[model samples]
Target: MSRLLTAAAVAVTLLFSQNALAEKVSVEELQTGLDHPWAVAFLPDNQGMLITERSGSLRYWRQGKGLSQPIIGVPKVWAERQGGLLDVVLAPDFTQSRRVWLTWTEVDNNGRAGAVVGYGTLSDDNARLTRVKTVLRQQPALSSGANLGSRIAFDGDGFVWITFGDNFHAETAQDLSALTGKIVRLNADGSVPQDNPFVNKTGARPEIWALGVRNPQGIALNPWTQEIWESEHGPRGGDEVNIPRKGKNYGWPLATWGLDYSGEKVPGSKGGEVAGTEQPAFWWKVSPAISGMAFYNSARFPQWKNSLFIGALKEKNLIHLSVNGDRVTEKERLLSDRGERIRDVRMGPDGYLYVLTDERNGKLLKVGLAE
Candidate 1:
């Protein structure tokens, strides 16, 4: 009877804990008129923020000034299906250089498409981007339009890290010569680092730091460890959280907890593990289609310190994971009541959490702990 009572108590505690976070959270609309906003990069010193729309527009927003007209001088993008202007992040020396980097799907004259990285100096008046230049482009543009995983980040050593999808071609993920389904490390100016993992390998792309990811849309440097973490979309299920390392292979079609969209097994998958592939730090049996992520290291939400916040596109919610070292101790899903596909989650410089909804008229929401 004592054992039964203890089990019952644990069940009740767990139930209340899950609901508590939801009830104690608040969402406020900062901008309600966005169109399919994909990412957010907060400006230094709270100057403002830059938001990217998948339909090839960049909007600037300030605290009391509201959203500005679309910034001019953005590159022409292939804004069809899953292709478009994607991520925008400030250069590490942004305060001094006023430079911002961006990623987008670039199309060739023959109609082939691939993701590219570029940067432009933000004009002093904030009216336009000037001096734009291309930095890197995925090699051998392809005909496919889906799964262009174009997220960008800067590591502590000032190296640029960009993620790419397999372009609906899973066979190329393990190919050393292919740039798809890979995490690439490059210098600020898009030059391949001499210390890159595959630099000396024969016939390999020297920019590749890690390989074998599928539709990875989330990338963030863990504040505590300074290590990069990624979230990826699997076929039917099997969404994963990974800490990508140099030369590591994150098994894709060859090992997954998911089946093909047609209810068949993935061609080479025996299970969720292959001898040469690294295991995911965590995985979901049912995919949530995660996107942008941010690590919360603020005091505004005392209960949320050391938590990792991720956007859930398929589930239309936000996920919070309490992380200690590299282990996840708790997981909670928030904003299910709103029924919006979350496209991005970011912690603001002012210690508040921001989220982007993916919709025809999407929204930029400011999230906080309920007072």
Candidate 2:
């Protein structure tokens, strides 16, 4: 018995020790003093980056220079709990069009709030996002500010993909009439594309691409497959990564791997998969509060090539996933020692990974190979 116990103890110690050693990359603070920074997007032509703060300020950053002042021209945002300026991305044709896309919690009629998208030109001076216009807005805004899953990803087909939260309306996740809890697509000009699944369907939002989500905050396209991949927060656990499909339903409140905060099962949850709903490509037994994502497609990190990078708010670490086809072959937690709630992760043009830590005094960190 003593021999057996000694062997087991050694194995456990080795397991944790191995994990600690695996996080070998070094992190450098690139910029700081961002108030609850939400997301960051690289600008075209190597100009700089667009960083959005939850307080409705759009700041710019450039290497060797510093963080620029908050760019002007943004409208008011509902900057309460879990609501604010969310994701920001540049149009794929930004080099030619000079357009920047932004998503935020917009105050709507009756004091309700909802996820809304808009675009405007980044001024020549890099000081303003002018001519801003609303591109899309989820329907029937609600008074609740939680679960506003707002993230932006440009699909390979020249369509813009946006995730609308279940809006704390869990039941609406199963309702096609509601735009909340859905992945929606739209043209660059905010027009409904004719190819959308529900373009002419009755009682359905033409922009909806997929439905039945909780609060998806991380969104990215798989570079190898050009597939739309997303990450969402579960009820209390069961954070997930899914490939939102055309007109498909990703079972949410009706079928989940998580229980309610009250320690009770969510009504209609079938414990993960329901007969007619889609399953997550990956899910966590314990919620990591996944927020942002990026695919390591650069040669600068050979070991991380083609891997998916995720930011965790509750876990306070960067997750490294080795994705093979539809399955996540492995997952590694990185940078947990920094103890910052990661808000966003993006790949810089210079082959480095940039991260935004969510906080009143947020920071931008660059992750690269250790010297």
Candidate 3:
């Protein structure tokens, strides 16, 4: 009787938990009126936020007064599907240096659109960007705008890490000579890091840090381990979370668990178990079109203190994954009722999770943990 009673009690608890999860969670809108807002980062001094729109403008978001006029000085962008001003992040020393980094897409020397990374100083008045200079540009730019992987993160050494997409060119993901479908590491000044794996190689791009990625969108550092983690989109299924190692390749078109949009096999893709390629730390059998991401290491939400949060574009939801060291222990979906594409997920200094929705009338929302 005791064992049976215990099993019944466990079933009741699980049922209640499921009910609670299905309950609608409320979200507070901090700001709105954005046009396909892509990414957001908080100002270190708490002055406001830096937001990027795919149409090639950056805006400042003040807490009380709302979004300031579009800050000028952004470079020209392609402004087409899957292109334009993509990710924006402040320099780690922004409080003092006032420097910011951005990644976007533009026409390259080959007269084709390609990914680029640049930096500029945010003026004191928060009106415009200055001293802007591009440091990285995709060589032999491709004509497609369908897959421009763009995200920024800083590792423990304060070096900048930037991601690039496959540009719908599957072959580029495996070509060491091309900058596409790879991550690059650089100094704060946008120079290549001396320790870069390809610096001494004969023909590989010296800035390339890791290779063989598809449409990576998120990159963040694990506060405890200092290892970099990333998330990416897949065509049909097989979204991924990866801990990209230096000089290694996380297989993309060459190896994937996903099929093409038409349910056909990717031209050159192998199964996820292919040899000579690194596997994802975590991956989904169904495509969520994962976008921005952040690691939670704050006191504000104790229950979720060490989890990973990711925004999903195709599924229009927020994802929380409980991680233990290198393994994902559990998964929870949040804010799915809204059915809006979550473009970005960021943890503010105050411990709140901020999100950007991708829509013509997009929103900046503050998500709170339920008690």
Candidate 4:
């Protein structure tokens, strides 16, 4: 009888321990009534913010003023199942140039669609875009509707890194000559950087930096290391967070730790032991559907200094990772009880973590350690 009681107690303790390890955090809503907010960028003066909706509109928000009417001048976009105005980033010289860069699904002739990046100058009221020009456009346009992974990051050296998915063509991920499934580097003016790895390679676009990615949705430059960190969705599991190095290949279709959604082996090599392909610094066996990422350098959350924050769409939480050099040693999940798909994460100018929820009527949330 005592032995039976002891065994039962042990089982209970194990269950409790598992629950404790995966504790769900309480989320306090900050603002509501957003319309599928996809991206958020701080204004030049740090006094306000510009947010992009998936339905092809930009909204402005000033402290205490709340969200303004959807700004005009946004280019027409094909807001299909997963495509729309995806990301918005300010130019490195936004104060002087007022130039903003955007990525969206552009509808072309014959009703075909492709992801495109463009730049435009903001009008005087900062409410409308003007002089828009395409900087980069996807090639060999896809026939199906899926996987338009697009994100933009600017390096301090005046270069832009744009990530593109394989457009549901897994084979394209292994092709170096293809721009899909690659991170491409370009000058601020949309020209291929002369120092890019493929500049001298025949039949390769000079902008190609690194290849073999599936869907890199989250991208940011680490302010301390200046290295670009990206998070991407996996087939069934194996969501990955990686620091992309120049010219290195990150195996996607060629290698993966995930299985297909149909419970079959993924169409790739099984593990990261393969040569010539970069391994992720960290990966989740149960995908979180990581969408946006930002490194915490704010004084408001001193306890979270130098950590990386990721918005998890599938898991509906904010994932915090501690980085030691290039290694991810610790991970914590926040706002798990909220049950809202977090689509975008950014550091506000006021030194707090700003999050955008993914829903028809989303909300702008501020995350800080409870005082």
Count of clashes in candidate 2: 0
Question: What TM value does model 3 have?
Answer: 0.92
lDDT of every model, 2 decimals: 0.85, 0.84, 0.83, 0.80
Clashes of each: 0, 0, 0, 0
For model 3, residues 1-371, the per-residue Cα lDDT tens digits are 11011211111111113334332344677776688999998887687788898988898887666777779888888889989999999898888988989999987665578888898999998888999999888775884778888899988889999888888887898888998888888998888889999999988899999998988899999997899898988878988999989999899888898998899998888787788899898888899899999999999777676799999998898888888899874457887767899999999988888899999888888776544
What would the TM-score be for candidate 4 when compared with the true structure? 0.91
lDDT of 3: 0.83
Q: For candidate 2, write residues 204-236 as lDDT tens digits.
A: 888889999999989999988899899999988
Q: Compared with the true structure, what per-residue lDDT tens digits does model 4 show for residues 1-371?
A: 11011211111011111233443232344556676889998887766788888988887776556666767777888898778898999999998899989999876676666788998898757778888999889875562547778899999898899988888787887777777888888998999878888899888877789888888889999988888888888888978888888988888877787778887877665564578788999988889899999998878767787799999998898888888889885457787766899999998777778889998868777766645
| Candidate 3 segments exceeding 4 Å error | 1-26, 109-111
Best by lDDT: 1
Worst 10 residues of 2 by lDDT: 3-12
Candidate 2 regions with alpha-carbon error over 4 angstroms? 1-23
All candidates in order of lDDT, best leading: 1, 2, 3, 4
